[model samples]
Target: MLSAVYKSLKKIDTYLFIEQRDDFSKVPEPLLAMFGTAELVTVLNLSTKDRLGIADINKVRAELAEKGFYLQIPPPPENLLKEHLAKLKEQGKLSEKYNK
Candidate 1:
């Protein structure tokens, strides 16, 4: 299936994929307001792609077929401190002072 991809100007690394080019009829008004202006990134033939860079291809196809659009948002930022603490705990290197 052919899909049009658009990048949001207000959101970093956020994209909207629609089944048809220049069609936002299925998208919600509030979502569009928050997304700001959308710039067309590219048109893709999903049938030719085995996987996408971020989104799961099967999920994307399902959403597009059911909801007429698929929204791709950036993954949450990593918490370095939490990860370090977990690693330290796993390695038995976390001191009582550090825990406090």
Candidate 2:
């Protein structure tokens, strides 16, 4: 799932990948180890059964499949989701990410 991380990861003061899917049971330990003690990265784990326990893994997966990758630009202050939402809603089907 980390493969779908946004290219511009921002303000990562701390992070925990609240894993809700059964598929992602292993940490990207090998990748992390490469950095070693030189870097400071805060990684934590949380199963789908966290606070609210909202496991929308399927939705996330579908979104990733449609986009050929999972990524989300943080919403703008005015919330432009409607514009994208409209475009997506208008489509009868989803397609893999098209590199425009």
Candidate 3:
């Protein structure tokens, strides 16, 4: 089965897959808001080998057939400690703004 792949404009590596282009409306409102506007990545035949980076082809197909959309969350950053430190640094700066 073929699938429509979309990338989230606001979030990195987040994707939404649907069976047809017209089926985008079937995606839930909360999901749409979280994903923001999705840019079309490609139309792919799911049976093809390695069509997806992380998600299982069978699970993707099952979700689409049952739920009309499949949400693909990004894998965690490779450097977990570094990401945590960066987030803490950012939050520290934001907190300073309020303290001033």
Candidate 4:
């Protein structure tokens, strides 16, 4: 299935995937309000049989077919936070040795 992706400016890490780019008009008003002004991310050939990077292709297709759009919210920021903490710990250790 051909899908068009939209990214929300107000909501970080949030997106909307639709079957057609022109179908944006079909999206509900309340949803558009929550999503804010969306920017086009990309148009991709998505298939259920093919593996997607972040979203399940089948689920996205089903939602797009039934509802006018599919919401694609990004995963938690835990990995970035963990990496930052690890870097901070390393810096702290280096500072302690240097100070000593």
Clash count of each predicted structure: 0, 0, 0, 0
Each candidate's lDDT (Cα)?
0.96, 0.35, 0.83, 0.82
The TM-score that candidate 1 achieves is: 0.93
* TM-score, every prediction: 0.93, 0.25, 0.71, 0.68
Cα lDDT tens digits, model 1, 1-100, are: 9999999999999999999999999999999998999999999999999999999999999999999999999999999999999899889899987874
> Which stretches of model 2 miss by more than 4 angstroms?
1-58, 78-100
Candidate closer to the true structure by lDDT (higher is better), 1 or 3 = 1
- lDDT of candidate 4 over 1-100, digit per residue (tens): 8888889999998989988985787788999999998899998887634866688877888888798689988887678855766687777853454443
The better-scoring model by lDDT among 1 and 4 is 1
CA error at residue 89 for candidate 2, angstroms: 33
10 residues in a row with least lDDT, candidate 1: 91-100
Per-residue accuracy of model 3 over 26-98 as CA lDDT, tens digit each: 8888889989988999988877756468998778989988988899997776998666667877777435544
| Model 3: lowest-lDDT 10 consecutive positions | 91-100
Model 4: how far residue 41 lies from native, Å:
1.0
Candidate 4 stretches greater than 4 Å from native: 77-100
RMSD of each: 1.2, 13.0, 7.3, 5.6
All candidates in order of lDDT, best leading: 1, 3, 4, 2
TM-score of model number 4: 0.68
Off by over 4 Å in 1: none
Q: Which prediction has the highest lDDT against the true structure? A: 1
User: Who wins the TM-score comparison?
Assistant: 1
